[model samples]
Target: MGISTDSTPRYTYQLPVAAAPSEPPSAAEGAAASLQDALLVGNLLWFVRLRWVAISALTAFGAAGLLVRGAFPPLGLRPPTGWPFLIAALLLLANFGYLGHARWIVRNPQHRGAAWNLWVQIVADLLALTVVVYFLGSLETAAPFMYLAHVVLACIFFPRWQSFVVVVVASGLYAACVIVERLEIVHTPGIYLDPLLRQAMTGHSAFPWVTASSALGIFFVVWFLASHLSSLVRQQERELADANVRLTIAQRDKTRHMLRTTHELKAPFAAIAANAQLLLRGNCGVLPGEAAEVVRRIAARCRRLAIEIQEMLQLANLQSADEQPKPLRLDLAEMVHWAIARVGAAAQARRVTVDADLAPAHVVAVEDHIKMLLTNIIANAVAYSYEGGTVRVRCHVAASDGPVITIEDEGIGIPADKLPRIFDEYYRTEEAVRHNKDSTGLGLAIVRHVAASLEIRVQVESAPNCGTRFTLRFPRAG
Candidate 1:
């Protein structure tokens, strides 16, 4: 419904800058403009149908003229039945042609043709309206008001100058129609459709000129108001869009700043944990029992915090990193075994049995990403499982399913309602937190991020007491 009449809007798109905030380009603007083109197409269809209605009305008026011609005297008014029918028939043919052109334009994807077709429709309608004006008595009837519809439509669909061009064209055409008839340049039986109205204006030599001037002024006033409002609306839209883009850029910059700050704290935390360990291990002089116990607790908390910090940094790095530059082929069986080994200590600590059903399958991906992805899943399975529970890992290539990996565990399972948030960074369900208080909650977030980077699909299934299953499906290689 909104239209721009001032400067053409410019659209551009660019990736977010790393060091400073900047406006991203309007990357998908063609898609945006297509909506307007689509709207224009719909409006054109509506107007084409409107013409059909006009044709019907004209035909009905002509029929009424014929019916009236026989019963009424020529004293008061006389309407020419044949001329009205001729105009309607001509309009019917033009409407059909316009409709066929519109259909042809829509069948093609390029919208440039649709715009030109609108130009033709508007101009052709104007020319037809001019004829209607002459027949209905240009200065005598209300036919000139019909020109305002096209004038308003032009302002909506085109820029200011083009709309003014339409206004000028309308004014000139109406003036010409009135003068020609008044001067008897093209003689007809009556100067007006209503004979009595023609008689009333016959003596007034300046009536046609005065009427034409008033109508021309009306067209200019309408264009000024419509085009001005349209320009204002479009400018506001652009300003709002730019403001939104700036807000998004500012938010992204804030996250990058926080993650960079977190990354910087990693070494200090590591050193603190190392020193605490040293104190507990008697690398320094032996501490008192109470001091030793406090140091032991301090070391554990530092190590866990260090792990959380590392995972947060990794998530940030993964988000900013480009796709693996030089991926290589690797055996899933070997990688799965390695990932199991990575989590073997945790499984042992929790008294959880880890089983692997590894089949020979080859996949191409960044070795480290897939390795970490699998390790995280296996580690999670072991972490959530009850003592003496079993965790199974499966890796195989199915004929239709391509390469697949599934890690299933008999753990304190996620609730159905909370399953969707399991991959959110630092997100853990109440049950997950209760079962394993040490979780960083970034394990599956990392897994899902890596899978997405590799274009792999992930599916999760779980029940409250029945544990959870994580399935990783690699897209079939072409």
Candidate 2:
């Protein structure tokens, strides 16, 4: 997901540049690490896909040269179809290997570092391209320009020093090929007619020297410009990430302050309810009929407010820092049963029957949060159900062994338009409010927080006056 660009802070003075990605604060190192890993994997995949284009270009070049071989001598050209086809075949096999290696890195990240994977790819690709450059004539054709692809990519994905290394290696390989060819140590049938204007150009002793020198200069110049631009981009990305972290910290601190304030408010609300109860019970003095009715309403509202406040505090605790419960492997079916038990009273009061279909499904998550998450959803299922309705609770693992739990209810279903806001704290649809007067509207919000914390996905399906189904897909336990 994209963070809001507006969050980037404006500065009046220029900031000093860092040689590397600045370290994110200690609290968010994991985020930075994850981002880098993803970038590596993504770049690896991109390079593999792009290689197919290179292979096709080679194939087409070979086919075209072969088809028009008759016209080559007239145009002072002597291209070889066999070499291009051979290079294309080599690239085709290597591409398959690259694809397999990328998948292995994704599945078994600990086996190899991402940087090592990228470096291997860069070296292999440069070697292959070096061969292509030699065959096509580093000074004879535009083939040397292909090295810029690696230079630009290296700049984008690597630090300044690492990018410099790639530039040096590429330039060196091209120079080596050119020097050996000129020295007649390795013979190459460069694409030129020795009989035509080509011999005049080739006879110049300083021509290859100047061409090689100019190409190397351009390579270094490109590395400098590309790396500078890439560094600026990296700087912006780090700043954006830091800004997001700060925003998150500010939000958590705000939740903590709200948690503290709610704690203080709870007592006053309780006292009000207690005094109202005393009046209703005639503990102080007998009250007139109208006053008694008024007291009853006040007491009822206070009780309802107290429940809302309690759920609010629960949510605040879940969102606050330093309060997440430790994760342990637990059975999804067992948690579902425990949740059913927790909501038994409400289900019984509403005459709602719960049907459970348990399967062997397990996940690693905090026990209390799991219970709280399940209990809240189950309670809502019961509360919203019509009298004598049935709520189905199912737990099972998917074919991939990722656990799934579903809670479906035969209730006054959520309106399609209002379903989006159902998880918003304190948000309730008019239909929901009319159906369940005492609904606190925080149950789903709490469930959402727990699901997010556990890395579970919650998908809802509903229709007005029909029924609603919530599907919770849990990440496979490690």
Candidate 3:
């Protein structure tokens, strides 16, 4: 080997080039793609089943036509020979095989190449229809129009180019059949060809050719338009899917940023509030009334800022997919009492009285989330209520509906126009802002998000100055 290397270099063989790796789909992208594939597969399976049913029905009808031909001669239907019936039975068997194939594809996780299966079905259908049309007097009767069904199915289930391929193959097969018949290359027995219609449009010399050309033209035009429209619809769907993905990513990023910023802000406000509290308590030194009052106000403002930051954080978490709620069995009445207690100080401050009608109702929900939901709605009611107004909290199980918790307030009610926007984050009705200048506008947004996450239905009824009622319908948990 050393001696050979000294004299000449050995040739090295190059390996075949490998394909580049494709990017893996994200969870959301994968889910969306799976949904689209499922829809396509479902449509194809439905069409296949429908075709089987149609074939069975047509076979029965054909058999009946043959049996009753002499009995009812005035029906004007010519009795077909046994050959067509035999062909139909074979087609039915083929269709049964296809149905089995389709079922396997649907049930098997490893079978992802469904498009190929669909193409096979389309081609098989086209060939079968061509044979039937030939047996039914090719071009003389309306049997040739049966090709339109294949075209329509291809347009719906296959890609544009695939559909075009179908149109071409179908048109070619039909034209070839007509030409062969006209040339007397193959004679189909017991089949009627209408001579008048064939010779009506063209002279005898080119009548069949002209008729075949016109039929081909119609097939091409119909398929072209149908395929074009289908392509447009598919393109729009892809564009919409991409838009949704982008929107989801953008929203997730926004929520993450908001969560981080709020967390950062909370720490500083908490420290400031603690220091202000210490100063207000005269821990440093004795202070004048004015300075003490100012310090107290600073402490209160810091506390309010802290609460607002907390609300923003909660809302961000609720909007995020990362935060899964921990659901547990909870008594509705106890949660309602806890919510009323949490807002007791606020209610007392506003001079609002809370009335409750308790009922024993069990539901599966995240305790903190439910508590937060109840607190926000009840606090909102208390905030909007006038001095000495009544806030009613009711927990009951309706006969038709499951368990219900309603918070009704005799405070300043929301206007009908603003009801739709009340749950929007950072959105405050003008009345709400006037009622509580310190409102963060995230309360009802949190309520809605939590309710939706817990699968609880919330309904709001309100009229300006009359009252606002918030109804939460909880699905009973076993």
Candidate 4:
């Protein structure tokens, strides 16, 4: 039996910052730990009463104790007059003591202790079995019970390989005991009961036949029980795994529903924002200076509101993507240039110096999805950056991966607490929401969803006042 010596280990989990990685324990280990704890709690009362060793130990000793007391001189029915029932009683008492020690070992689970206590119990059991076999005068009378206990111990405390080895050792002990008894090597008293061979049968020896039948029965019964227990454990493990899968599906469905609602709301608001911008640009004819400026501010706020709504919808769509990615070979360098060019006007308006370094390669990804991922990241960098600051967009080949893209901006960066959850839907940092009051906080969440579907990794590094860098690493084409 390999023992568990570590009380705890680090667990990994996925974080929300785009493709940030966090370590948490796998589902299987957690399920096993929960099952073990539940079983312990369910049997708490019984464990406390019997001191936590197997119930068989107590029952076996109790039965033998009753038999020993009943076969006393006062009963006046003892056929084996010279048999040492007292010795059998003493062996039963010793078993009780060993069980107490086993319980102690169970209660105190030492992560780095020797197996000294376990070895001691094994030796004590062996010695006790020897005494019983000698006192009973024959293997047919005493050795079967000892063999049964050995089998039980092996199943409870040992691995399959070790358990089988112990079973072989137990069978050998039985053979040795039987041989010694048959040869009359021991001179203790023996008990002989009548054998019902036929209708006219008289008293006949049945010890050999009975012992052989009992051993055969024990082998089959233990094997069946072990097989049944193993099946139960496997069935429960599968059920737990299925439940976790269902939970993930439900979470996605809820996120999708929210996104659809946001999209429905944004469609009308986008038209309203556009018309307002048109009027402010003199489409409705010229007006006084002060009135024109008021119209301009209203148009700007409406545009900001539209952007926030669009971001919310983006968050919902990112998490709700259920279909397989429609892959096609396309020039990724051109796509990057296209995205940067789309956002170029806005960056130039803010006096933000935008730079790009692109690599020539074909990438297989959905065109619209990649566009959204790139646009949001670049826009966020430009929006946060000060006038005349730099926003760098780089695309290159990674040594260990496929295409690697990074967008970095010189701007007031994210705080430590807010950085970890930057990709969560509707999650906005104080600084981000302050920069644009109507920020929808869905940009990074959409980025995560797209990367997850493509089996890509996204990472972010940022510190307050030190600017932020976002990295996207795509898997190579097959």
Q: Which candidate is the best by TM-score?
A: 3
Model 1 bad stretches (over 4 Å): 1-236, 321-338, 358-368, 395-404, 447-457
lDDT of each: 0.77, 0.82, 0.77, 0.62
How well does each candidate superpose onto the true structure, as a TM-score? Answer: 0.60, 0.69, 0.83, 0.52
Q: Flag the better candidate by lDDT, 1 or 4.
A: 1
lDDT tens digits, residue span 182-254, model 4:
5658754433332222212212366554665577467547744764565566567668866665665566667
Indicate whether candidate 1 or candidate 2 has the larger TM-score: 2
Indicate whether candidate 3 or candidate 4 has the larger lDDT: 3
Per-residue lDDT tens digits for candidate 1, residues 1-478, read: 1112245332211111122222233422444466667777787788889888889988987897787675445545566658778888987888888788778767875845667767887888888889878876787767898999999888877777888888888988988988888887886655344655676875577777787888888889998998898778767866776666566556556657768888789889889899998898899999999999999889889978988887776676566422345788888889999998988888899898998999988888878877888888898988888899889889889899999988888877767677767777789988888878898989888876787677777888776666777777887655
Clashing pairs in 3: 385-411
TM-score of 3: 0.83
Note the residue pairs that clash in candidate 4.
11-23, 11-24, 12-23, 12-24, 13-22, 13-23, 13-24
Show the lowest summed lDDT stretch of 10 residues, model 4: 194-203
Give me the overall lDDT of model 4. Answer: 0.62
The residue-by-residue lDDT of candidate 2 on 252-303, one tens digit each, is 6778798998899899999999999999999989999999999999998998
- Give one digit per residue, the lDDT tens place, for model 3 in 266-346: 878889999998897789998799999998889889978888999998888777777466789999899989989999998
Flag regions of model 4 displaced more than 4 Å.
Answer: 1-249, 252-256, 278-298, 321-325
lDDT of 3 at 411: 69
